[model samples]
Target: MNTPTRTVPGQFTIVLHSHLPWLANHGRWPVGEEWLYQSWAGSYLRVVAMLRRLAEDGATDQLSLGVTPVLAAQLDDPHCAASMYEWLADWQLRATDAATAPDPTRRELGVREFQSAAAAIADFEMHWRHGASPQIRSLASAGVMEILGGPLAHPFAPLLDPRVRQFSLREGLADARGRWARQPAGIWAPECGFAPGMELDYATNGVEHFMVDGPTLRGDTALGRPVGDTDVVAFGRDLTISYRVWSPKSGYPGHPMYRDFHTYDHLTGLKPARVTGRSVSSADKKPYDPQRADHVIDRHVDDFVDHVRRRLISESERIGRPALVVAAFDTELFGHWWHEGPIWLERVLRRLPEAGVRVGTLATARRDGYVGAPVDLPASSWGSGKDWRVWNGPQVEHLVRLNAEVTETALEAVDKLVDPAGPRHPSGYRGGRSRVADQIVRETLLTVSSDWPFMVSKDTAAHYAVDRAHKHAHATREICDAALRGRAGLAERLAHNWSQADNLFAGLDARRLYTAALPSDTGS
Candidate 1:
C-alpha cells in the first residue's frame, strides 16, 4: 500500500470580549449594580479557574482571551480590588458556615460544596491577586492565552474623535502592559467592529494582530485572512465555530439541560432552575440534573470538535495552505447567560487536545506562518444595522449633535489660547494652568464614549445613558466658557465635578490627544 500524502494543518481560535461600564457606585446586582458583584469580574474569575484546572492537568496550549480596557479597569479598580477580596472572604465564610450547619443531610452536602468552593476561591485569589491580576499575566507569559487589548473605555471606535480614539487605543495598550508586563500582540477591537483606515492607527500603536468579522475580511466564516500589507494581520471570526456553541436563535443555552437566565427568584435571589427544562415560577424551578448536563456537554464538545476537524480538513484542501477558525463573542454570554457555560468550557478545553486539534492565539498562528495575502477591508460594526446606526440612529441623533457641539467648544477654547507657555496660575490642575482647559478635556473625552448613544438607541437604560451624555457635554461647555473667560474661581467647582468621574487618562496631555489629523471643530 502507498503512503497517504499529508495536507496542510489547520487551526481553531476563540476570542472572548469582556467589558462592563464604570459601575463602581452604580446600583443593581447579579447582572446590574454595574460594579458590585461584577459579572465581568465573576466571568474572569471563573474562566481563569477553568483555565487553571486545565493547565494543571497538562492540557494543550490553545486559548486566546481578549479583555477590553474598560473591563480591565473595573477588575483592576482599587475600589473593586478591596470589594473582591471581601467577597471571596464572605464566600468562604458562607461555605464554612453551611458545612457545619444544623441540618443532617443538607449539612453533609454543604461540607462538600463549601469545601470545593473554598478551594476554588483560594486558588482564584492565589492566581489572580490584586494589582498583578496574575491570571492575565500568567496566561500571557505561559502562551496559553493571547491577551487582547482594546480602547480605553470600550467605545464604539468609529464614532469617536479620531485623535482621542487614537489616544485611547494607545493608552489602553499601555494599560494592558501595565498589568501583564507585556505589550499586547493583538486587540479584539471592542465589538469586533472595524472601519477602514483605522488599521493605520493600530499599526502606529504597535498592534501587529487584531480580529474583524468574517464579512469584513471578505472571507467565509471558517477561514481567517490577513488585511492589506499594513503588517497588522486580521483574523475573521468563524460564525460556524461560534454558533455551534451559541447561535442567535439557538445555542447550548437553549438546550433542554441548561439553567434558565431570566427566571431567577426575586425574593430569595437565588437561581433555582433546572438545566433540563424551563422555569414554572420563581419558587417552583424544577430540579437540575448535572449528570444530564454533563452528558449534554460531552455531546456538544464532541460535535464542536468534529466540526472543527472537518472544517479544518476541507479548508486546508481548498486554500492549499493551513487555515484558521476564529470564534468570538461577549464573555458575559457564558456564565451569566448560560449557567452551564463554565462546565461546558471546561469539558471542551479538556477534550480538544485528546481530539488532535491544535488551539492557539493569533500571535502563535502568525509566528507559525499561518497567514494569507493581505486585502482591503470595509467600514462596519457588529450592531443591528451593521453600520453607524448605533451611533447616528434616531434615538441618539439629538444627543450626538450635542456631543459634537460641546466638543467643538472645548477644542476651540484650547486652540484660541495663543500661547502654550502663558498662564502661571497656582491653581492649574495636574500642572496645566488653564482651569477651564482641564475640565474641558476631561468632560470631552468622557462624553465621546460610543456607549452613551448605543445605550440610548438600544433603549437599554435610555434615560440614564442620555442623561450621562448630556451631563458630560454640558460640563464640557461650562468648562470651555470658563477657560475662555479666564475664570480662576471655577477650579473648586470643576474639582468637585470630576471627583465622581475619575478616569484612566485623568491627567493626560490634551494637546497630544489633538493632532492635525483630527476634525477642526468637530461641531456639526
Candidate 2:
C-alpha cells in the first residue's frame, strides 16, 4: 500500500469489468447460462483466488473490479448459485470421462481438466456455494480493490430516456449497497457510454467518478478530468498500454504456445490444442503443453511489465507531471477467453511493483491527486470506431427505435397506473404490496440492455440476441397494456409469471422510477 510520491514517477491502474446480461433461465449451450458458468469458474474464481493470495502478502489497491448489478444479482441468485455448483460437478464428470479415453493425448488433456475442475469445485464449496457477493465483498473489505457499480441491467444510458436513465442509475447503486454494504463512488458506466449531460445524472446519484474511453477525453488519459462543470471525474482508459496485452489483431494470448480458445474437442467439450497458428485448421493444431505455455506466460508477463513501466515514465515526462495510466478490460477475457490469463495477471501485478512502477486502483488515482482540470467529454464509447456505432449503428437501428418505443410506453403506463403517494403498491391494489409495476420496469430495463444490440452488430449469437430483445420488448408491451386497461388481475398474473425467469433485484421498488427525479426535473 505504498503511496506513489514525486519520486515514484507515475502510477498504473487496472480495471476489469465483469458483466453478462440476465442469462439464468435463458438458453444453455453456445450462448446463455453457459456464458455465466464458464466466466464464473474460469475468470471469477481464478481472479479472486489471485487477489486473495496477493492480499495475504499485504497487497492493497491491486485493481478496480466492476461487477454490473445484473451480473451481481445472478451471482447471488439462489437458482444460479445452485446451478453453478451443479455445472462444476458436471465439469468434473466430463473431465473424468476424458481421462478414461484410449488416446494418450486425450488422457493428458483429461488429467489437466480434471485437476482444474477439482480445484474449482473445492473453491466453489468453500467460498462460492452461497454466491459471489460474499467473496467480492471480502475483497473490497480487505482493501484489495475498489468495486465499481453500474446500471441495473447494463443498459446503454446514453440512448435511454432521461427519466429512465436517472432511475436505472439510482436503483443500480442501491442494488450494490444491498449486496456489498456500500454503494460505489465510481461506476464502469455500462460500456463506457456517455453523453453531454449524463454527468449531471451521475453527480445527482452521488457518483464521484466514472470511466470512459481515451478518445472521449480527446486522448488526454494521463489525468482524469471532471466532465463539463460537474465534479464527477471521468477516467479514460489508456488503450496504448492495454492493447499491448490484448487487442483486435495481436496480443500475448495469440502466441503459438498458449492454449487455443477456438479449437474444441467435440467429444469432451475440452480445448486440447495450442494456438499453433492463426490460420491453422483445428485438425492441424498442436497439442497444448502446459510446460511450454508456462514459459511463454512468464516471458509475456515480463514484457507487459516493461511496457507499463516505459509507458508510465514516458507519459509522465510528456505531461511534465506524475501521470496515471488506466488499463481496463472485460473480466471474462482472463481465464475464460484466454486460458493463461489469470497466471499472466498475477505475474504482472507482482512484477510491476518490483519494477519501480506503482500499481493501484482507479479510486486510488482519483484520491491521490492524479486528476487534472475539467474537460467536457464528447459522445463516445470503447466500441468499434470509439463511438456509439456498435450499439446504435445502422445494423442495429431497429433496436434503437424499439428501445425508445418501449421506454416511452412503459413510462406512460407507470405514470398513469402507479400511485404518486408513498406506497409500495399502486393506487388501485388493496391486497398488499403489488409487483406489477416493478415487473413492468424490470422488463423494460432488460429490453434496453446494451448486450443485445452489441451481439447483433458483432454477429456473435445474433439470432439469440435478437430473440431476447424482442421477447422482453413484447413482455413490456403486453403487461403495460393489461395494467393500463384496468385489468389488474391479469396484469398481476403476467407480472408473477414473468418474474419466475426475469427476476434478479427482488428489492427493486418501481416507485423509484417516478420518485427519483433528476435536478433538471426540479429546475435546480
C-alpha lDDT of all candidate models, in order? 0.66, 0.89
- In the range 278-307, model 2's lDDT, one tens digit per residue, is 999999999999999999999998888878
Error of 1 at 19 (Å): 1.2
Best by lDDT: 2
Residue-level lDDT for 174 in candidate 2:
83
Give the lowest summed-lDDT range of ten residues in model 2: 515-524
Q: Per-residue error at 348 for model 2, in Å?
A: 0.7
Which residue runs does candidate 1 get wrong by more than 4 Å? 1-8, 28-36, 57-61, 86-132, 221-223, 275-284, 414-442, 503-507, 514-524
Q: What does the lDDT read for residue 401 in candidate 1?
A: 82
Worst 10 residues of 1 by lDDT: 515-524
lDDT of 1 by residue, 286-378 (tens): 545556677887888788877877778787788777777777777777776676777777777766656766777777777877777777888
